[model samples]
Target chain A: MLTNRSEVVVKKEMSLLERIYIPAILAGMRITLSHFFKRKATVNYPEVKRPFSPVYRGQHVLKRDEAGAERCTACGLCAVACPAEAITMVASERKKGEENLYREEKYASIYEINMLRCIFCGLCEDACPKEAIFLTDRIVPSTFKRGEFIYGKDKLVEKVDKRVDISKRQTQTVLEFKQNKKFAHNRLYTDKQLKEKH
Target chain B: MLAFLIYKLILVVAVFAVSLVVAMYSTYAERKIAAFLQDRLGPNRAGPFGILQPLADGVKMFMKEEIIPGTSNKWLFILGPSLAMFTACMTGVVIPWGGTLTIGDQQYPMQITDINIGILYLLGVVSIGVYGIMIGGWASNNKYSLLGAIRASSQMISYELAMGLAIIALVMHTGTLSLRDIAAMQTGWHWNIVYQPLGFLIFIVCAFAETNRAPFDLPECETELVGGYHTEYSSMKLGFYLFAEYINMFISSAVISTLYFGGYNMPFVGRFVHDPNVLAVLGSVFLFAKLFFFIFFFMWVRWTLPRFRYDQLMNLGWKILIPLALFNIALTGVLMYLGGRLH
Candidate 1:
């Protein structure tokens, strides 16, 4: 009664051939035979993978600076913004001799993200003021142990030699904003600006 | 006489092995064909195109925990599947697979035994096959199993009538009870299917019901009765029941091929091949081709058609097929009479 799509049931008596059901069965068989020749819908999952969208959010990654230093200043903004509350970290001041490793004075010492709890919403990527955390397209490989799923900085951090390309993640406006060094939040200070600050 | 006995022994073992192998592969083919029809790749992991799937299934079936309910009649439960498997394997003996092989002026027919009343033997064995389901169902002490058994027995009894009548129509034309003679008569494009088209139609439909295949598979219908007759059966016992169904399918296909189509007769090839041995081998291959096509047809129909409702099944069996088969017999008699008068 919601719509006019429903048909009334008719009680018309069938003719002799129709009552027999051979012609109808033969017609049904013809349809199935045609489908036997048609292209199969299955994609062999392991050997062949279907393409994913460029911005498809999956596993999380911690970005490294140009000089091979950790970009995270232990701001805790990503952790606060995560709806799942999957992120947790401990802040530690950088030592005098560890300047090459740490981009900022304050950095995360123990960063852990429980992958089982993380909903892959890309909210953490949006909330990262330092542009340190990102949701990359690389899938999280399954493991038997629950403990193995809690990804540490070792698994999350990108290697210095092997950089994960995240150019597609940012929009034109965000890329344009990075060029303007007027904002301190950009974290792209010139050498003169550093000296002036000192 | 001793040499003939040895040859017969060897032939018996070969036929048994062939039927077993065919039944095993039928399961694999059913899955693969179903996948193809649904536009999906099925079971390609076990081996190249999943050829070793049946072997894996066999091992799994053997390794499964055998369960017999405490209330069940244990001896009859054991007897049920064994009887089913026995009856399934019994039908292949009488089929004339190939022509005679002449060895030093001695002829060796490519069949285990050419029983004169082969069709009757087949019908008798097929009727006995219902006992396996009935005993299993009744012995299980489950209401569903009993219902399934009742349905199966009734279905088989109803359909066998039509199937026999259909065969009677064919037999009237050939005037022989022996399968070898029937196969031999259909030489040079003179297949019985050409004459007995309507009879073949009825026979094929009844064959579907007889084998307990889809559209006629109400005995083990999953929707209403959970696992049906073999509800309480487990492990290799259950495997035996399932395996028996496939074997029945293979045998029915062979029967259909032998009776309707030219069983082992390849047209024009016999003229080219002068040697008897080579001809016999070629004949066996041709017969096997027909058997495989019919098996494929069984699987094809299984996937295409939905299972019939219980009352619809009974109605079709009793009302439609029986009357049609009777009409065919009368028509065959009249036609044969007219042809003789004309001659």
Candidate 2:
């Protein structure tokens, strides 16, 4: 059984200075004053760019072969890979005498990808056997129209020859076909000749 | 007479320009101070650490479309912020910024207007500032706005009593109503705050309530009122309301400095600066420094404390402030009488 206790424990009284308003106000002022001297966290935009991740998705670019020919071989793999169902490709057969221009027998004559529909997934690159398409490090420029985003072959293709030259000593494996200068003559064939042979 | 009128006109324009500019910069200062407290950089992109931010803000305000509510009284809606801004600007007139600066034969007082009943004039002007809030709230035709107006009016009235009582104690001690004369009385070590510390506390709290600053900012409570009184106002009209708030802040700071902190009088400043003209300028600078300190204090408190609830604010003003002010007054009277200080 517990008995009730009447005695109360006395707490320390507030000081006269503490009870007065000035000290409390001064304390609050001190906190604000300290903050006023601290460094500002604002990053000056435009002049200072924020760090972007390595896998950041930006503009799309179509890859090219060493001979500067477009790598896309009329393959509709990109259209299937897009999650957004944004990619649309129109493939056509390579014209007569266009074998040197096109890598594959069947080339995309009117290859136009609707960029508006493209989800910018690297899955398209994974799906392509030829490794034709890729997203560049550069971000896509902002535009107003949906129609302007439909990228044609002219807009997607690499404008410059971006191949890096290797030293002759660094070439570990020399192909047997390049041993004879006569093999180079046979390699330069017209689209008709190559198609007929195939 | 024409030249004198032209000069007075110039002075009025000068004071208005200076006060408006100061208020605008004070907003920037408040933001910078808040950012500094929170360990973040404030605006610094507009022009050289965002010095032209006020200009940009002014341009933005001007460019914005003014919206008037269909059900609201348009005339009173316009009148509200105008009145607020007007009352705020008008209070600066009585503040004695510096003593007389004599150049050759002419001596000019560094004050806009010095009436005999200067302290009472300030009190009356400050009291009228409530009307702007009340009118804005009423005209907004919003339940929240009306509630805010009602709260603001009641709170202002309650605090005014304590504030008035505190002023009375100061007046009793000083035996003068003119601010210039009151300032003159506290020449060296005899500042009003030294004699009336209790009165100063009451007055400062009442000043906070009167200005609708935290923890007494129940009128424009964002959580409850959704912008409170001027909810319906937009464009430059809304800008006017914001501008008026900063101006009111500046005026309140000036009033506090003038009343308790010896206006512009600096201790032993006279000994170093022999020239009256230099002393006058220095005095004005001292007054500005004191005002700036109070302004920073206001911003500091705003960031630190949450606002008081309506009933809590009322209780603070009526139950605590008023009674305490009365007691302080009684105490001052007894002390002065016993000490034979009062003539």
Docking class of 1: medium
- Candidate 2 chain B: minimum summed lDDT over ten consecutive residues — where? B2-11
For model 2 the local lDDT of residue B303 reads: 81
The top-ranked prediction according to TM-score is 1
- Tens digit of lDDT per residue, candidate 1, span B1-343? 9999999999989988999999999999999999988888888999999999999999999999999999999999999999999999999999998999999989999988999999999999999999999999999999999998999999999999999999999999998889999999988798999999999999999999999999889999888899899999999999999999999999999998999998999899978998879999999999999999999999999999999998998888899899989999999999989897211
Candidate 1 matches the true fold with a TM-score of: 0.92
The CA lDDT at A101 in model 2 is 70
Give the runs in model 1 whose Cα sits over 4 Å from its true position.
A1-11, A171-198, B341-343
Best candidate according to DockQ: 1
TM-scores of the models, in the order given: 0.92, 0.82
Q: Please list the residue runs of candidate 2 whose C-alpha ends up more than 4 Å from where it truly belongs after superposition.
A: A1-33, A96-101, A110-121, A161-198, B1-9, B38-40
How close is each model in CA RMSD to the real structure? 5.6, 9.9
User: What lDDT would each prediction earn against the true structure?
Assistant: 0.92, 0.81
Model 1 Cα shift for residue B290 (angstroms):
0.8
DockQ of every candidate: 0.68, 0.42
